[model samples]
Target: MSLQHFSHQHPLVFIASHGHEIEKVNCSACGELVSGSSFGCVECGFYLHKQCVEAPAEMNHPFHRNHNLNLFTRNPYLAGTIICDFSRKTCENFVYHYSCNLDFHIKCALFSHSIAEKKNVEFQDISRIDPSINTGNVTEELKKAECFACRKPLLDSIYFSPNCGFYLHAKCVDLPAEINHLFHQEHPLFLQFNSQRLSCKICQKPQGPEFVYCCSPCKFALHIQCATIPTKINQPFHRKHPLILQSVDECLPCQICQETTNLNDFVYFCSICKFVLHIRCVSSPLIIEDKLHHEHSFTLFPRQVLYCDACGTLGNYVPYICSTCGIFVHKNCISVPRVIKFYRHQHRIPHTYFLDQNESEPWECRFCLEEVNTEHGSYFCSKCNYIVHVKCATKNSRWYYEVDSTETEEATDSDEPVDLREIHPHNLILSGDIRDFKQCHGCLLPIDTSYCYCSQCDFFLHKACAALRAKKHIWFHYCQKLLKLTSGCIFQCCMCKYFTSGFAYTCDKCKERFCLRCSLLSDMPKCEGHEHRLRRFTGESKELCRGCGTSVHAFICKPCNFNLDWNCITLPLKTQHSFDVHLLNSLITLMITIIQEVIIVIFVKRKGIPNIGFIIV
Candidate 1:
């Protein structure tokens, strides 16, 4: 006999026994196993149990009351796969779709049971743990262990599960449908699965399951893991007291790495000493095997150190020192890329742990235009004479590898001529004549060491200046922009009133010019010699250099009344003087001459010698 069924359009036939040959057949209506006598269509292979074929087409489910639920054997939305809202699992069988968006498993929609209504639900573990706890799961020992919600490992002792081996945290199972979070106080956060691939606000990283804490109205979503980070804790790095988690509303420098904390993330704050540390920095490993340098491992130190071998800055912060290589680097510096396409250079630049001191003159950085101490670590080009500071190369993200890096040759600081499209149409040849000083076009400072200059156009540039990128982001500038190098006009820098006939990064819209020296250093720098932080003083007032005693523009410590000039801070330890060509023996001869002059002048009434000037001593 043939009978019409709601699940299929074709007529169904009553099959008494299909035998054991058809070992498995499923009910199309409720998606259950079919056995014994069943109703089926031979042509379409649509089978259903006798009771399922008699079920209603539409029904009201207690869990969702806004709309009537419709049974669907196939996904109507054509989204390929759908998630069951009731069971919080991927649905492959029959589903009940409501309001054109909400989907539920057939079992959850018809035979619904809230977490509280389930008889197997346990409350023994939830009562002991703090209600507001953010992290860690209740302890459990099971052969096949899984959390009730996330289905991940539960390492702590604060979870509950219905099955003997399976478990989940009480917090995850008991999360309210909606909540008000301190980080996002403006809107109410709702618990839902993120099907839109929204990024998490706290970690700034995206890649996870569908379940998340979300604010549908604002489209703000955060991963469940980030939302559960403890608000306060005593960190192992700084263990004096509890470190409270604070939002980054303003620029606050991290005490461990000494870099400004990103405004989007949370930081551990110690209000008593104004100490702040980034979550990543606080969790840095004591010993790390850096990827770029495979020769030796680096160990972290807690005390403040002298100089950073990477950025070449004097700051108080913890450093990662490699005892085998005899080098000290900031924790953040360890993450600098081994090979980078710097905005300022045409070829790929690889980081060098040490530059050979065999060069006639010191190599200066192309971006900052500062002397690159060969004794420290820096990025160098093996193909050409190009070198840059680790921090300077990464300041802006403009210089990224657009093409395959393997196609380009390695960079080197060689004595080859370079062609600059911004400068004259001719290639500028490298000159290593220290005796002849030519004003550089970029910084407008006299180049006393190595330089690249065009004999045809009378254009000159410090080897460093010639390597400046077409576009860059300086420390003082708020945003990155294309820097145009221009000359043939007298320009005075707005920050530092220095007259420059050489080239500079010119802003035609703002009518501002910035020399290379002023662009390298930030307004606020922590100096090794000063007790308080030093601020760059640009006013045209006389300030004595604390080290050299020369009156000029200098960085000042307002509280201590101490000032240091750029020339004083960057002075080389040893220098060759014109008066003393004979090294150590010349100083002794000069002392003897001074003593004889003193004897002759004191013992005998004598006038000044012919070529000898008045002896101030």
Candidate 2:
């Protein structure tokens, strides 16, 4: 259970001695055999634990399964829940019966099935054929078994249960009662195992239906409930009030005593008066339908006034609101969905809110990329021009959007595009036919051939870019606000320490993840490239490179020892320098007149001149 660089393919690997014996088993995932090597792969029934065939396949999940699943086994006789034809929601789908006891991630246990393994791990030789493979040669006929599927104790990693006397923990028998959840796949899952009191659409409280997903077609449900949520909550009819997730769309009055908005769409208020209320009054399945905003389906408005294109203000309470196209909200503003994967937009952007300005000049929100308007409240995208607020569209479902469904995509020698194996280096190809159509140049979003592309550079990327994360910036450190990830093995280039590829930019406050080939690597950095304006000094590094003074790492003027790297410390303050004049920033007034003409030619050639240094040269 401790082991983790990562490996667990059914191969829990044990050998045994005490005269205790079941004798043999096979199939960590297509190993086949199992008549007494115990069981797995009948036609791909797949089950394991002679030590899980030898573990080490791949993992990273949540209720949001986009890809990153490969590990299967289970003798068949199923029980389901693998739903993700692409965000319909149901644990993001990944479950196997004879094996995956309750875990998931093999494309949610066979979505279209056939998960690209390609073939590699094949090294046999326990001792040629079988001293019984190990525990053999000494048997009283051994057969104490007991795990048709949860009978328990087949001892260290076993799984006999396709139907019978019992024995699974071979880690709970590839656990697949049914699951296709990367955030609810079209819904069609099962496994109640009793425990159903229900209640909590979200905090109404009282759970236990095992873990919770349910959907008998569309009754719709979910519950893991309680990981941590209590920033501010108190409702004895508002109780003097104390609320703050800020950005309240309208004027700012009825947050309780501040008073102003009254009619409807006003989620969590009373900062002073507007007095809005209704996250479900308290919470419960009151109409939802979100595949990260697949066009429209949010209804809950109890009072909704109208204004709030994102945050101009007007609407009042009960607002999980959609108003069709205009904009009017407040239904607890959405939120929740993360399981590993992030490049920024391979189709993982939930927890939304907005609906007003609609976009004319100012715009930004492509799922928390930021910069929006309407007084500071937005989330528009009637289908992409973008707009965001509700604190940049409610981030923190834990983040996962790694989309790289490739056909061929590459581009490095500095044209900028770390790696986009399946359209999502923040996506930006635009044309078409990367092997029959692909697109997602960062939210332009669209794809059709299964995906993972970027072979040479036509471009493509999708498994959500393996969950991009970079907002941990370090222009010179202590600035933060990063976020731009995709995946890795190395990643150090906020602008050029090398070791990079596949874009990056993370920072939830400061785990710091940089990479984007160092944020542009240089058109201006040599020794803090000083034309002026660089602060902070903490310790001391000498500093020097204004393009080629030599000794610089990136941003460090501390009064002009200067230094700039990370791609010239994020260049582009404004540059055109040619065709229509746009070079601004005067390069420190041309490096102070070339150090004032070399200090007046060394003060008149050291006074008294060698012929006055030829009349000051």
Candidate 3:
């Protein structure tokens, strides 16, 4: 006779006895092998035990006395899987659920009810028959005996078969044989021993020889803990679209941390926008409060941007914004240093958003030698009129160090108005006015204004140059030795290779010489001919100097393709020559005229010139 059931669509036929053809059939209600009398829907491949087919829709089980357990064909929760309280495994078939977070499999609920009534049954001595069991002071032997179901130690309530050496947790003995998960919907996952040591696709963690939900054909597996992760989630930061859990083979950058995700890691992705976020970044904080960077708090702006106001570099993804300051900056730029001491400059520089504009002269960066945009942020020294790009100042750790805001800068002798007798044999007087032209003995540059002069000898030094220390450490020198200030002999500079009679910083150990101008130059030198900083040419072959057209040691401006030799770099700004009636405008022009004169003399010598003796002085 055919019987209608609420769980299945088709009418179930009563099978009075199990035959060879239906021996392997499992009950659809409890997912257990059906043995005795049962109901079968041959067309749908569905079956159920006689007791399960006659079970009531609602009942007050003794295990949960507070509420009535209602029968459910599928999980009632909107997301994630439901685990049975008795089996400790996912409930994929019919279950008895209560609104108060209690659930049980159909067979488990029936067997539990039968035991409560003291029915005649085999295996009545099972430990699970008694709800309470003493688990205190468990011996080492019992601790070593792990449950065959979950692979966890059977320290508490468990079902033990001494003759068969089979151990199972009280709650694990009735685990469902198979389950269907949201992560993999192609096939039903079966509860099996993880003998191959496969990693869970959801958490990407290696699984030991334990029970897991696995699909043999697809080689997909998931731990019981990882199988509960929801397939879709609504993150607070990304509210436009709900992110779906997905597996990716390529490394993609996470929008929150701006770091590349590991290959083959599970990520929360938005298929509609192609937005990817690392699984870890899903819980990033919405707001950050850093007192050191700014007075106001910064809120995370969860969108891609092109620029950052702090570092002035291209921003990749999300940026932090301070609404009070009306600025958008990178997350990494929030802690940028406010004041720093650069190795190239004597005074400390402070960060500023915009420089004070002098209409006559635009601000130029001392490091890159490029025009500074007054609208953007930069490092500036108001005392020395020195300014540099923010990136150039803090590019390298060895170039600068942060300075405390409250610390006072040390005063130099140049700032003081006094006569010095210790520096020279005669008292040197500081004067702003001098009638005759004088050259500084230290740097050999023209001392036009604010200089120290000695009456006993022709000793003169620029006010700033006279404040130099007796010994100093320069970063450009590889010897890492302190160079001493020495004078009185002409020597070639190791850096610029220029021969000069000016003061030199000499290293006694390596015998390396550096002229005053070369020693004072930073690693990146400023040049007037080009709009960019010049770097030393350390190539194997000599570069052709653009100034004199000679292949020699030179400094190059790569962007401009400009090169300057030492001889051209150190040429005085103004010079007096007998061949010119007025003072030569520039030493560069004088050198060019000399080159032209030599070329004319060679042409005259090759042809013939009568009594006009072409002489070059």
The candidate that wins on lDDT is: 3
Name the lDDT of candidate 2.
0.38
**lDDT per prediction?**
0.62, 0.38, 0.70
Instruction: Report RMSD (Å) for each prediction in the order shown.
Output: 19.2, 27.3, 21.3
Q: Write the per-residue lDDT of candidate 2 for residues 1-617, one digit (tens) a residue.
A: 22211323332322232123332433444333334333233344334534333333544332223334444433222566543222223432123321223343333233212111311122111112122244653233224543322322343353322232112333333344455543346765443321233543333445432334455445444443221233356654446666432235564343222234333333465657646543434454457776553356666554435454334444443355565764544443332221212222222222234343334665544433334554534434343343334433334333333223332322211224334443233444333343433443222133443445555564554444332332222333233234444443333343344332344565556656555434433322443334665432222354565655666444454445555543445443432222333233244334433553565556546563343222100
- Top candidate by TM-score: 1
| lDDT of candidate 3 over 501-611, digit per residue (tens) | 667888888999898776666556677757887766644567789878999867778667788876566565654443554354345346645664666566556666543
Superposed Cα deviation of residue 212, candidate 2 (Å): 13
User: Any idea what lDDT model 3 has?
Assistant: 0.70
> Which candidate model has the greater TM-score, 1 or 2?
1
**Candidate 2 off by > 4 Å:** 1-328, 333-371, 375-388, 391-393, 397-617
lDDT of 1 by residue, 301-384 (tens): 766577777666666566888887777888777766767766555556777776644688768665554577766678888666
Q: Which window of 10 residues has the lowest lDDT sum in candidate 1? A: 608-617
Going through the candidates in order, what is the number of backbone clashes in each? 20, 194, 0
TM per prediction? 0.46, 0.19, 0.41
Root-mean-square deviation of candidate 1: 19.2
Give the least accurate 10-residue stretch of model 2, judged by summed lDDT: 118-127
